[model samples]
Target chain A: MMSLRLQLGIIFIMLVVAGSIVHFLRRKSIDFRYALAWLFVDVVIIILAIFPRAMVWLSQILGVASPVNMVLFVGLCLSLVVIFSLSMSVSRLADKVRKLSQEIAIIRKDVFDGDNRVREEMNNIKD
Target chain B: MKKLVIIPAFNEEGNLEKTILDIKENAPAFDYVIINDCSTDGTLAMCRRHGFSYLNLPVNLGIGGAVQTGYRYAYYHGYDIAVQFDGDGQHSASYLPEMAERLEETGSDMVIGSRFITKEGFQSSSLRRLGIRYFTFLIRLLTGKKITDPTSGMRMINRKLMEKFTEEYPKDYPEPESVVTVLSEKHRVTEMPVIMNEREEGSSSISLGNGVYYMVKVSFAMVIARMKR
Candidate 1:
């Protein structure tokens, strides 16, 4: 079982991290989908803090030296997941930007040419 | 069949006019569009002044994105055949009709213009040739298809492959990777002997400094491309 001071400390840090994440989400500084991952990590830590006895039992079964090490290991895994997701999002956004730029260039050419076959088709329909 | 020549240009202000003229003289049966990839030079102005059919990308998309944009344009315009012609004055337009003819005669989905086949005209530097040979060997090993000049920018694709290219293409140094994609799908590919000219203006995009990166990235991409099926 964790001491009262350690339990309070863990809860305090996690609450503060969750608060900042929510604040950033509200302020639109970060995307909700991305912020949610951080919030999830914080929530897992808070749950572990609330149940230190459970963490100690699980750590023993998993061969961890201490409950704190167990918490750190879990946090590391979650952080890796978040970071990998961020890389995926970056690649997706780059692809989207490329496609958008290509489309915009084509549209600009259609507008510049003033001989849009579509416009001709529309006129023919009216006639 | 409606045919389109895709000329992807970047800061080719000195060479574009002549390249377009070469197309007009040699491949008059086909229409052409210049993909001006946000050239900081007078390329855009040249397109405007001559009233050339062009799509000016608002940003630089390197060679692959620029060529993919041309494929999209070809797809939307309903071109039955799409020819990729360089705007650097290195690729002669005279081979375009022959390429298209071979594509029809052999019923291949893609046709590559290979300088090594003829051993004629400006064969790139010895270092570049060695690099090409390595790629040729790698691709043949992976897909069992020989691509004599895997780095040639001049090629023609039928409507089916043109549509495929519109959906996805490599972002940089895409030639060898794209060939792998097509060949891995068990589609037919052909190569025609063609003479190429030395570039009259502007520097080649692939410099010696990043040659290693180019090889590693392209080789990885080709492996992934073959396995993507």
Candidate 2:
């Protein structure tokens, strides 16, 4: 049978692995421009997963006590989830902004060209 | 008054001759500059045949770029008034004097040929009509001015406005957005009642997907315009 300490570590590792997997899958549809942000988020998760003690220290500084271990573990897990969610939101927003800019650039180019192709395409879209 | 008409022509081979000839016959006093947007058709040939002043762009630039080029020419050459003429034949030259007179009387920097100023026939697609309505709402909200036809290319601007418009003109379907531009610059923009004829030849380039794209793009631009000091 695994010791309590090893069991806790295994659970932590599993949780981190599952989260990373889900995050990777979820973010796969995002644009390549957001790769750096997602990568940084993944790196933070990896660091937090490897050093559970760091989380304990953080909890202590935040005034978490009485069932210190439990509180720290839950706190760390919640913090990681929030961070991941925020990173995903930011990545998505970045993609939206980039798409907007590119569309503007193409339209801007078309205006000067006088090809009327863009206008025709827009008319067709309206129909 | 020495007036120069700036006509932005893009793939307008079909209507170029007639439009130019009409302008020549009606407003012969007004010298014209047709900005050829690297037309693949016989648009340039028509300009040459009519002996109209023209500038051929190396590559096709949309209405915004072509119009801005005209403005730049107007600013540099010292044109008293610059009128934006559409090569698509939607605008009539007969209304030029009336539109110009309105601008002169009001001391307005820009004068727009508004179809809604009177009962004018608008032949645009229904979706475009809705888009124009939305744009009209947006402009009124932003500029505190009730602009009926925000996308009319038949407009006139004086030397002062020509200088400013030449400096920075909106690219990509600029007509609707230009009201915001002129308003933000604290320039007076007035609209005149004028009827527009339907585009006679060549299909418009705007598509549904492109329309959605245009909406988002212009919305973002409006936000930026609002944020400007």
Candidate 3:
């Protein structure tokens, strides 16, 4: 069982994290998906803090001798998931940037050169 | 045929003038578009002064993205052939006509201008030659085809392959990976012997510091590309 002091500390820390995430969500400074993920993590931690017996049960099911070990295990798994998602976001962003830059360059060349032949080329792309 | 040479230049201002001049002198019939990949040098200015056709990317997309941009231009402009001509002055424009002719005559999807076929011109540093040999062997093991010079920047592709390139191109050291891609898809790829001049100025993109990383990335990409349908 978690002592009251420890549980209070956990709840206070999670509250701060949740507050920051919500603030960013309202300001639109952070992506909605990422904000939601952070909030979910906060809620999970809060639940474990509030019900230490739940953590004990989870630890038992996971074959972890101590609830502290279970907490570390969960934290490690979540971090890996977050890192993988970040990699995916970066990859997608790079692809979009490359495509947009390529299109902008071609459009600029057509307009800058001022050749109807280039315009004809633009129309040819549509075909 | 509407052939367009795609010269992707990144800080190659010193070498670009001669490359374009060579193209004009040797392959004047083919149209060209210089893909200025956000060069911080005088490459764009030189292109403007010379009145050369060019596409200036607002952001630097590296060699792969720059060349792919040219392929997109070739695609949108209805070009019959698109040739990847390096702007570093290492590749000669004299080979363009013969490469395109081989592409047409042999009915191949792509034709690569390889120096190893005749062992003529500047054979790269021995270390780099070893790397190219490894890739050549790996590609053979995977695709059952011999690609003497897998790293050659001088290559010509028919409209079919050009269309494929516009849709998607490998962003990482694309040459060997793309060759595996085409070969896996069962495209007819041929090699034409050509003399290549050593890079006139600047340096090759793969240098000593990142040589190992380059080898690992390219090898992984080739194997993955080959495994894909």
Candidate 4:
């Protein structure tokens, strides 16, 4: 059984996270796709806070020594997944930025030269 | 056939003028573009003053990114062949036409300007030569293709390979790894004998301290690249 103080602490953390997610969503700062992962994490935390016995039961089933250990293990795994996803996204963004910069350089040249021949030829080739 | 030479320069202000002049005087038939890799020097100023044909990268993309930019330009501009020539005055423009011709004659997708093939002209430091030899043996062990000068920056690629390179290219210290990539992709890579001069000004980007790191990193990349298939 979780102590009242521990339960309250978890509740406080859930509220803070939920508030931040709401604020981010309202401001449209993060995409819904990315926010969905955070929302899922929030839901898991809330569920664990409400039913502390679930963690105990999971801990017993997983042969872990304590519910706290189970919680830490799950948290570490989830953090890994989150970090891995973030790294993948960062890699993709880097590639996109690189491509954008290359295109910008080429387009800037075309614009400055007052000749659309290269641009036109590129578009025709793409077509 | 329209050929484009890519001169990737980074803070090579001292040599850029003479290099450009040499290309204009010797390899005038081939169109050239200087990729100024966000040099923190008078290189860009020189380009603007001379009104030289160049693509100025807003950010420092390193040598790989700079060369890939040139390849991308060649692809977009519909050049039949693209040659990568260094801006440090090390690569000879006189040999460029012959390199392009070798690419066409042998029906090879790429032609490398090799110094070791002739065992002559600026073979680099002995330690660097050892690293090159190690990579040569490693590449031979992995793939049947043997590259005498895998680290040579002077290379020419046909349009087909240029299209591929524009899409994807190695990031840093890319010369040797790119050679491995081309070979693994079943592309024909041949080498032509050429004499490379020592850099006229500025030090090489690969310093003595980082030489070991470079060798290890590039060798690791070469092995990992082979495992992809």
Alpha-carbon interface RMSD of model 1? 0.5
- Per residue, candidate 4 scores C-alpha lDDT tens digits across A29-106 of 988877877777777877877787999999899998877677668767776777788999998987887787778777
lDDT of each: 0.92, 0.74, 0.90, 0.88
List the candidates' TM-scores in order: 0.90, 0.64, 0.93, 0.91
Q: Candidate 2 residues A11-82, lDDT tens each?
A: 576567556656766879554444445555445554544565665676567765533354446646666765
Of models 2 and 4, which has the larger DockQ? 4
Best lDDT among the predictions, by candidate number: 1
> Which sections of candidate 3 miss by over 4 Å?
A60-65, A115-127
Task: Order the candidates by TM-score, highest first.
Answer: 3, 4, 1, 2
Clashing pairs in 1: none
lDDT of 2 by residue, B33-148 (tens): 78887788888897778765677766555677778877776776678999999888888888887777888899999998888767558647777888888988998888788888
Cα lDDT tens digits, model 1, A1-127, are: 5688988898999999999998988899998889989999999999998998878998999999889888888889999999999999999998999999999998888775666677888899999
DockQ of each candidate, alpha-carbon based: 0.83, 0.03, 0.84, 0.57
User: Candidate order by lDDT, highest to lowest?
Assistant: 1, 3, 4, 2
In model 1 chain B, where is the ten-residue run with the lowest total lDDT?
B51-60
Ranking by DockQ: 3, 1, 4, 2
What is the two-chain DockQ of model 3? 0.84
Query: Which 10 consecutive residues of model 4 chain A have the lowest summed lDDT?
Result: A109-118
Per-residue alpha-carbon lDDT of candidate 4 for residues B1-229, written as tens digits (9 for 90 to 100): 9999899989989999999899999998999999988899999999989988889888778898899999999999999999999989898899988888899899999999999988888989998888889989999988888999999999999999999999999889998888888899899999999999998899888998997889889999999888876
